[model samples]
Target: MKFVASLSAAAAALGALAMLPTTSAHGPETREEVVKFLDQQATAYHCAPAVAAYTAARKRSWAQKVLGGAPIADQNRFIDGYFEAKGLDGEVVKKGIKELEEEGKRIMACDPVVESKIRNSTCVLAPQSTEGPYYHTEAHPIRSNMAEWQLGLHFEMDVGVIDVETCEPVPNILVDLWHANATGHYAGHPEPAPHLRDEKPAASGLRRGLLSAYPRTNHVDTFLRGALPTDQNGVAHFVSTFPGYYTGRATHVHIKVHNEWSVLPNGSFTSGNLVHTGQFFFDDDLNESIDKLWPYNTNPIIALGRTRTRNWEDSLQIYQDAHDNGYMPTFDVEKIGGVLQDGLVGYITVGVNTSASYKPVWNPNSGRAGGVVEQKPIDKATHEEL
Candidate 1:
């Protein structure tokens, strides 16, 4: 009887081991790994009173030993607090609560949209990866509007920063953002992607290295990129065109969070700790709708009749931005007007551990953010422009 019990215990342990997620040295090599990691972090946030009593009541079950859990009215007030603290209009908070309650206890554990909304309200950690090849550190203007007369659908983004360790809003931190224009070209970089000009596909290896450092072209143009310090409420706003898709990736935006950063005399940020590097994506249905629009339809690569990669199809990187249960590195967008072309607004809350930092590599010869040009010839193989 003892031997039989030992064998069963061993079998059960192995089963649990098999259920754990596995990742490559580079990070989150599989979709399942990405989803599982996100779910775990989000679950941790909800289980603990990291931010508010609401989180505790959110997951409390009547069957649990603890009694007098927060009621639905309390939950509504908790949800309202976030918007009220942000100074948002009362109508918006009321509508947000209505929808949040409608979702009920299921929480749609795996749905990206639901997760995006939940994470936006609470301080949950965001994954730090996939800065992409086009990033030019310290080379973005400190301005609210990054559009610079670029032709595309207007987009306004409100990004909030929260220190996950304390579960509180973080102020004065620099948030830098960049993305492709309507025609699938990033401002300042001449090529859509490294060595993939003229409608050619980038190598799979290059796709995997989306977060790896690439040599900068040092181009002078700075459209579609901007930086700003978060306010006391830990929010920064920017106006830009909606991001268009590039080859080998989905429609996404790149973000970098900086701490102890200073603004340069040239109207750009200087030195700071790169605390978090991550990407945000739009839903595939939204992407498809935008692709039919004027300037986006004019993208030369897509004009060749090639289909762009969808969110799920870009298996390597998209999963890293998504959580299986709690968080998604995507925006909760709302139409500001009757149509998308009219205008759109999006909001995302970034959760970061202020104690952590990163040293990102970029082109040393890149031009300054304020229209100072330094042209250089890039070595295609090494992506090094010397």
Candidate 2:
């Protein structure tokens, strides 16, 4: 994929651009001027209301209410009130307050026009880091004639836990899953052609039996959303093939977790709350090979790197951290060269139990406690971080 200059640099440039006051509270029309005006409005309001207020109260009297107050004090008070209302304790509230200060500074630095645009629309600077070959086929449909091999791209990943305060992994947690098929396609897309059922007499295909066959085709509702169970060693595995690249993003898998707490209405077990959202990658050779083709070439995030294995480890670590707080893990896959495609593996380890008060509904079949269970309490002998 063609690489754009670093997103951080772009943000820095935007920050610099924000400083140029090309437009006054009232001024001539120019792109720079428009951007400046928007930035100013953003600094004043910090939200859509600020922009609306600036526009409506351009007469200064309203401007004072939107911009003239003791901003730092007001911000502190607002954050305090927010934390209080949210039932956060002193530490969490303090952390949130600090984050707000940082955000406030970023907001203050933005050109009013840029800030206004951000508030008014979903536009923002591009990301500094790569996210994925995420699926975005809502607009066009994949052709059915695409060969199965051409359509399925393999993705593999690992999962684990994190520290709630710093968002880093603790250790030894299992992640499991299933995902969409290749061709950047998923099941239940409203347009159904590749059927997912079996009515004929004994026609079977690989990965197309049981769960695979019940939904029949990858195009039908089977690839992306099954909750897999973890084993005693805190590891889970899936047999999904790779997924194809999509525009603007990289290839990735979506996964949810099931822990000691997850339960179901029928007394069976469900997975734990989701813990991460990340992507897995193949080696550089694989990326280069894929980049030589279409779609993948157009993606901006793909890049050649010498330390792809390191990158893989780093990415997996991040996924584990994201899930530490009981959130599902999401990750991307980069097909590198020379890796074992068939046995591509991912791992995760849980750390300190952050879900102290989180009570999971009990599932008798899953062998977990509590109609609900929390992470804090564990079987001491096992030392399971859960």
Q: Which candidate ranks first by TM-score, i.e. highest?
A: 1
Error of model 2, residue 327, in angstroms = 16
Encode model 1's per-residue lDDT on 311-381: one tens digit a residue.
65563544444442345566656665456777776667787766665665433222111121223343322
Determine which window of 10 residues in candidate 1 has minimal summed lDDT. 364-373
- What candidate 1 gets wrong by more than 4 Å, as runs, is 1-42, 46-122, 192-199, 202-218, 318-326, 361-386
Across 1-386, the per-residue lDDT of candidate 2 in tens digits comes to 11122345435646565555532211224656444543433322222222122211111221134336323122321212223322223244335435454443344343334432223211111111212222222211111111234333343333333333332223333343333344334554422235533232122321111122222223433334333334332223344454453222233444323233344553234434423323333333444454444543443223422211222223213322332222222221222224434323333232223344333332212212223323464444443454
TM-score of each: 0.65, 0.32
Per-prediction count of colliding residue pairs? 0, 67
Error (Å) of candidate 1 at residue 17 is 26
Task: Report the error of model 1 at residue 44, Å.
Answer: 3.9
Candidate 1 displacement at residue 206 in angstroms: 7.6
List the global CA lDDT of all models: 0.57, 0.32
